[model samples]
Target: MQGKRSNQIVQNTAFLYFRMLLSMGIGLYASRIVLEVLGVEDFGVFNVVGGVVSMLTFLNNSLSSASQRFLTFELGKNNIMELSKVFNISVSIHLAIAGLVVLLAETVGLWFLYHKLSIPPERFDAALWVYHFCVLTAFFGILQAPYIAMIISREEMSLFAYISILETVLRLLIVYLLKVIMFDKLSLYGILTFSVSFFIFLLYWQLCRKRFVETRIKHFIWDRKRYIQILSFSGWVLNGNLAVVGYTQGVNILLNIFFGPAVNAARGIAFQLQNAVNNFSYNFQKAMNPQITKSYASGDMGLMHRLVFVSSKVTFFLTLIPCIPILIETNFFLEKWLGKFPDHTISFVRISVLITIISALSYSMIVSIHSTGTIKKFQLWEANILLMIVPISYFLLKKGGTPEVAYWTTLVLMIIAQSARVVIVSKAIDFKLYTYFNEVILRILLGLPLCLILPYWVFVNMNEGWSRLIILVVVVCISVGLSFYFLVCSKSEQRILNKVGFGFVAKFQALISRYSLNK
Candidate 1:
């Protein structure tokens, strides 16, 4: 079972890596095209508008998490029939929620456009169109919540990866179509892209139906008790989502309101870079999620604990490795890929990366805590901090008089939230926060010195041109390689190396078998 699990992890990791590469490739090209085509103000306007509407997705996304947790837990118990019931129940709930979100979007969305954000009158129509299309996409996505969770529970990562790649490719295709056609109706572009994504989600839903017997929606009615339970879970989740909304989308909107679209463009670039770097770690977490759920359900506390620790370390380093180049070559990479923009983008990217790294580490712990039933406690504290984020951010952005101030407020808030969660996790899971800090947190600390060195070296020596990009990449590779060798690797890793042995061992065995067959 251990060997099988190891092999499965290896396979899933490979698939995830492939998916990230594809997604990043699309991101690189798409960022360049969008930046060039839309210009800073329009691009920023789109982001601000989209960010506002995106808050509506909070409940759907949060509920999907609950669904994933329940589905994977059932799968862990090998309760196939119950898994189907959970799927149906989750889908039923999600549909109802999506309907509510759509109705809100149609009625309240326009008022949000005119009053809440900083979109200029000339750009309002364009922004509104983008928001409308995004609303439709969100609706489609929320409705497919159970299908996505089912795929994760089954560990059918390849299907998810393929679907994701197709989605990115389709999005890219839509961008190119908009560029070539040069459509005056910019909203139509938003509509087209989202409609395609919706169709793809439908395809995934159909595939889920064919693949999982448990995915069938029978004549199931919602139990008042279960409905209330789900709603109660979603209510807390809605608060958490609101916090996320405030921290992420709220910050963007605030930036737009105070700083204008140009600064928002810079923020957008920084955010894209943050999101891209985030995808690297996301791949591993997604792969391990089902395993974590299964381990917890079976009361395999030892394995579950081990998996949590290992995942944190691996994800930490995986993200840390690439961020070095990003920090070093932020301007060159941005200018080279997406052309020049506001001056503060590089700083924003660097600061945001630091915050994202810390948050991502704490998030791993959160995922582990989530496997247990103690989510509400964590959620409550996180929500409080999250709620604080908005007022604090608004004051910070308004008073500190810089875009970076907004990020600083966010960083401080995330740190407090993460620290509080550490305490919560320690009490709930009996996992020592100091041990996690010593192991995972210390590696990050050691890595920071190295990450700092590359940028300093690049700034001193290399200036401009492709060599800068090359040098940055090389330094990042060497630094990360050395850091892991010294800080992360252990005797266990070396033993695995020895078990795999030299590449020639398998080749030699094959050769001997061939000779015997011929003789």
Candidate 2:
């Protein structure tokens, strides 16, 4: 059973990796094209305005996890009937939430976009147009949640990856369309983004309605109890999600008020690079999350503990891979990737990457806590900690601190929040705090010294050029690989890595042998 779970994780990760690569390629390309076409101020305008409306996403994200957890839990029990009920109730809740959001977006969200945001007077109309369609995109995305959650709960990663690739292709098309269309580029981009979102949601809907037995709308049955259960679970989940919104959208607003749209442009560039780097670990986590949840449902605390620890370690390495080179050469990377940098972009990217590293360690732990379905104290404390970023940064900037002050605030808060995560999760599970610190956290800390040596050497010796960039990447690759292999990984992990390597080679040899024999 353990081996089967491991194989499933491996297969899921294999699919997600393909998704990541396609997304990275298409995302990097699309961003460059979009940035160039929209120019600096307009690009910033889109991000900031869109960001305000995105605050509505706090509900969307919270319910996604709530829905996926209940669905996966029911499937683990082999209760298809209950699963269908859960699906219907989740959709009902989401539809209700979507309506509420539209009401708010038209009233409160619209007012904030116009009155509170620091959008330029000239581009106000473009920003307003973007806001209207973004509301549509956000609404449809919420309604699309149950199908997406169902797909993920079934561990149908290939379907998920394929849908993502399609979305990537559509985004590429949008960028292409952005160039030739004679209308306002910003508004066109906004409308096209909504159209793409709606189309993708339809694709998910069609696939789920056909494939998943529980997705038949005609047979769907709703339950008030199930609604209450999911609501009870999600209500506690709301604090953490709202804090995330505050931490992100709130900070973006603060930046706009203080530093103007050009600063927001810089921030937009930083987030693109950050998200690109973050997608590596995110893909791995997506593959592992279901297993983590399922193990708990099966009363296998032992397997749950092991999966959480192993996943945390592997994904930390996944993040460190790209982060090392980028941190070593931020200016060079941004200048090459985007061909232009706004103010504070370099510092923002660096700080955000560092925060992502700390956050990666706590991700599996958080999933474990969620699986237990008792997270009120955990969410409240963590949310408060994260919520500090906005006001802290606000005060700092008011005192004349740099824009980087916000992310620095985030970095400090994340460290505190992560430590709190381990503590909170410890009370709910059998996790040994000492073991976590000794086994997982210690390895990462020990690896840092080794990881930094070569990158620092390259930084001091090399000049700013393509040659330097290439050499820096090579050095980071070699050093990080060696450190993770010799320093971070256990003997068992190293053996697993070796076996996978040898197995692939052996398969290739067997294939070649058969071909030669046929000849």
Candidate 3:
């Protein structure tokens, strides 16, 4: 059973990585084209306006987390009936949340957008169009949450990957159309983007209905106990999600107010790179998340702990592989990717990479805490720590701090938040903080320097060009790969790697010999 689970994880991770690679490639290209078509000011307007709607979608995020946890826990117990019930209830809750979002977005979100945002007077109308489309996109996304949760809980990663690829391709097509079609590029982009989202939602809805019995709602479930359970979990989750939204989107609004749309454009470009790089770790974490939840639900604390520990280390290494190259070659990459990106783009990308590295280590721990379904205290602490970023950033920007100060603030707060998570997780699951520090943090600290030394040295000595970039990437990969194998991985993990490597070579040789004999 353990071997089977491990194989499944490997297979799912492969599918997700395929999806990430294609999506990231196409997404980076599409973003470059969009920037060229829309120009910086319009791009900034879209980012900030869309961010306002995303702020309210934190409600959707909170409930999405709850839905996945409950569904996965029930599936782990093989409670088919309860799984269906949970899905229906989750659908109900998401519907309510979706309506609430529409209300908040129109009244409060709209008012704030018009009154508080720093858009040019000419672009105000375009921003409003973007806001409405974003609301529609969020509405569809909220309604689609339960089906997505069901797919993920069941570990239907191949289908998830397929849908994600389709979505990315559609968005790419939308960007292409933005260039050809000639009606208010900003407004048209917003509408086309929403169309892609709505179409993707329908795909998920139909796929879940056809594939999973749990998704076929025969009747509305009004389980008071289940409602209380999910809502209780999500309520605390809401606090953490709110803080995340506040720091991210809220800070984007602040940048717009303080530094104007051009700066917001820079931040947007930075985040595009951040997302591209971070997807390496995020895909792995997504593949591991279901296993963590299922293991805990089956009361396999030992297995769960091992998964969390190994995954935390692996996530950091995965993030570091791409991050190291980009961190060293930010300006080169940005100039090549976006011919004329906004100011501060390089600083934002560098700082965002650092932030992503710290945050990557927390994914497995967060999943483990959610699996236990006792996130009240955990979420409270994380929320309080992360929530500090926005106000502190506001104060700094008000006191004439530059735009990068906001990202620096986020980096510091992220460190504090991750530390608090480790401490809380230690108590909640009886996780040994000493073991975590020694096995994960300590090893990373030692190995990271080794990973960077060669790459940085090559970067500094070499001139800036495509050849240098290629060599730097190769050097970083080799350096990080060796450090991960020798310094980060435990003896048991090394043995597994050796076994897998030998097995693959043996299989290849046997296949070749058999084919030669037949010939």
lDDT of each structure?
A: 0.78, 0.87, 0.92
What's the true lDDT of residue 402 in model 3? 92
**Residue lDDT tens for model 3, 1-519:** 765676678778889999999999999999999999999999999999999999999988999999999999999999999999999999999999999999999999999997899899998898899999999999999999999999999999999999999999999999889989979999999999999999999999999999998899988989999999999999999999989897789889899999899999998988878888889888989999999999899999888888999899989999998999898888889889889888889899999999999989889878989999999999999999899999999999999999999999999999999999999998888878899999899999989898999999998899999999999989988999999999989999888667655655776799999999999
How many backbone clashes are present in model 1? 0
Model 3 segments beyond 4 Å from truth? 500-519
Instruction: Report the C-alpha lDDT of model 1 over 232-271, residue by residue, as the tens digit.
Output: 6667666677888888888888887888888888898889
Off by over 4 Å in 1: 446-459, 493-519
Candidate number of the best lDDT: 3
Model 2: runs farther than 4 Å from truth?
499-519
For candidate 2, write residues 1-519 as lDDT tens digits. Answer: 654566677778889999989999889889989999999999999999889878977888889889999998888778888888899888888889999888999999887876778877888999899999999999999999999899889999999999999999999999999999999999999999999999999999899999997887774456767777899889888989888887788988899999999999888888877888888887888888888888888898988887888888888888888888888788888888889767788899899899888878878977889999888989988998998988999999999998998999989999999989899898788888998887788998888787788888888987889998888878777887898889888898787777665766776799999999999
TM-score of 2: 0.96
Lowest-sum lDDT 10-residue window in model 2: 1-10
Listed in order, each prediction's TM-score against the native is: 0.92, 0.96, 0.97
- The collision pairs in model 2 are none
Candidate No. with top TM-score = 3
Task: Rank the models by TM-score, top first.
Answer: 3, 2, 1
